[model samples]
Structures are given as structure tokens and as C-alpha cells.
Target: MNGPALFYDKAAFRKAGLQPPATWKELRQAAAKPTGGRSYGLALSAVATEEGSWQYVPFLGSGGDLEQLDSAESVSALTYWTSLLHDGSA
Candidate 1:
């Protein structure tokens, strides 16, 4: 199926002593590290526009359907994204 895919530099990951992330939590943890001095773990489009919301579709989907935006799954997904921002990982 078509979906979001993660692309990372092997050399960089090796240098950082990190393996490929296998889960969302793991990805978030990995993203939290090596972020400093203009370095970011992930590149996210948070602009206030349709494109910005489009970029977050995968994350929202992980939470569940759009019919229930306030569902637990949806909240969890949003919380995850917010954490990434708060931790300066994106």
C-alpha cells in the first residue's frame, strides 16, 4: 500500500550508534537525539495551510479515522506530534 516512508542516512545513523527505527515511539526517541545547533531529526511541514495538514495525514491516520478526530487514537497521534515539537525533534 502507498504510505509514508522513512529515509535516513546509514552513515549518520551508524555514527550516532542508532539503528533504524521500527516503531513510532522508537522514531520519536531517535528524533530527539542529535538535534542541536541547527540540526533536526525530522523535517516537518507545520505551516498554517492545507499542505501542512496534508503532511500530517499519516500521523492522524495512525490514530484512526477522520470521522472521530477526538478519538483516543487521534489524540495520541496529535500528542506524539506535539511532543516531537516540544522536544525540538522536528
Candidate 2:
């Protein structure tokens, strides 16, 4: 059987003219906005499975360093992720 929709609020989103963010920076900014405590900026599947790997692909791809995960670009990407977590966006 097919799984439930991974995303919620499709109808509301349609009304709001919402579109998927084109860049990580845009996503981060959106998530950081205050929405009267009724909205979340971001959420990712951290479950120990393929979903986790999928969630991480953006950072890895942006960094362009698979062999050296600790490269400067990687660190920057990780820092961005940490900021989302700290800001309660992720």
C-alpha cells in the first residue's frame, strides 16, 4: 500500500500560493519566521532509515564533499542545519 502523504496542509498551501523553497537559505528564513506559535518552520525525518539519508542529501550535495565530510563547506552546511535545530525550525 502507498504511505500517507508525507506533507500536510496541501489545501491551505494552495490557497496561500505557497511553493517549495528553491534554496536552503530561503527555507531557513521561512522557518525562522514567528507565526504566533501555530506554525513550524521546518521538519525533517530523522528516523534511522532511508529517510534520514534523504534528509541529509541536500547538505552533502551542497558541500560537494562526500569523502571529506569535515571540509569547510561541509561544516558550513552542518552549521546551517544546527541553526535550524537551535531555532526550533527543524
Candidate 3:
């Protein structure tokens, strides 16, 4: 599949003073913020659908060696996902 449109609501983001995060750590930390009376940081698509796989792209991309799915980086990605679930963030 091609993917969803890569558009950003610049006006809304500008109104919120949102800047592009420089690192993955920053992104995760930002996501962990409590807002709108919600406890979780971000929303994840766990449904067995195209969106679910799409949502997981970052982890897969971060694996460094896509040819080796069982690489340490891939394992780390899975671990992070599990951690999010255990901590009620996923």
C-alpha cells in the first residue's frame, strides 16, 4: 500500500507551538505527556488491519538490518512495544 497522506496540520501545530522533535527519545517523552484528561501518551492501532502494521513501521525501520528480522534491534523494538503495553501506554 502507498500509505496515508503525509500532511501536517501546520496551523494547529503552530498554534500549539509544537516543534519537530529531534530524536526518538524526545518523541516518546512528548507522547508520554498526560493531556485531554487522558492517562496514556499516544494511540496505537492494535487491530489486525493495515493500520496496525503501518503503526509498527517505526520499530521495523529501526531494526537497522531489515534482512535479519531477529536482530537485536528488532528484539529491542518488540521489547519496547511490550513495555508500553505493560505500562498501560499502548
Cα lDDT of candidate 2 equals: 0.65
lDDT of 1 by residue, 1-90 (tens): 335567897877888888999889889878877788799888887789876777777888675666887899988888888888888998
Answer with 1 or 3, whichever has the higher lDDT: 1
Worst 10 residues of 2 by lDDT: 1-10
Q: What is the per-residue lDDT of model 2 for residues 1-90, given as tens digits with 9 covering 90 to 100?
A: 213223535654455456655677766765565323656756776879876655765676685565787789878877887888877776
Residue 80, candidate 1: how far off, in angstroms?
A: 0.3
Off by over 4 Å in 1: 1-3
RMSD in angstroms, candidate 2? Answer: 4.7
Arranged by TM-score, best first: 1, 2, 3
**TM-score of each candidate?**
0.85, 0.66, 0.60
- Which residue runs does candidate 3 get wrong by more than 4 Å? 2-20, 35-38, 64-67
- The runs of at least 3 residues in candidate 2 whose Cα sits more than 4 Å from the true structure, single-residue gaps closed, are 1-19, 34-38, 49-51
Q: Give each model's whole-structure lDDT.
A: 0.81, 0.65, 0.58
Highest TM-score model number:
1
Note the residue pairs that clash in candidate 2.
Answer: 31-41
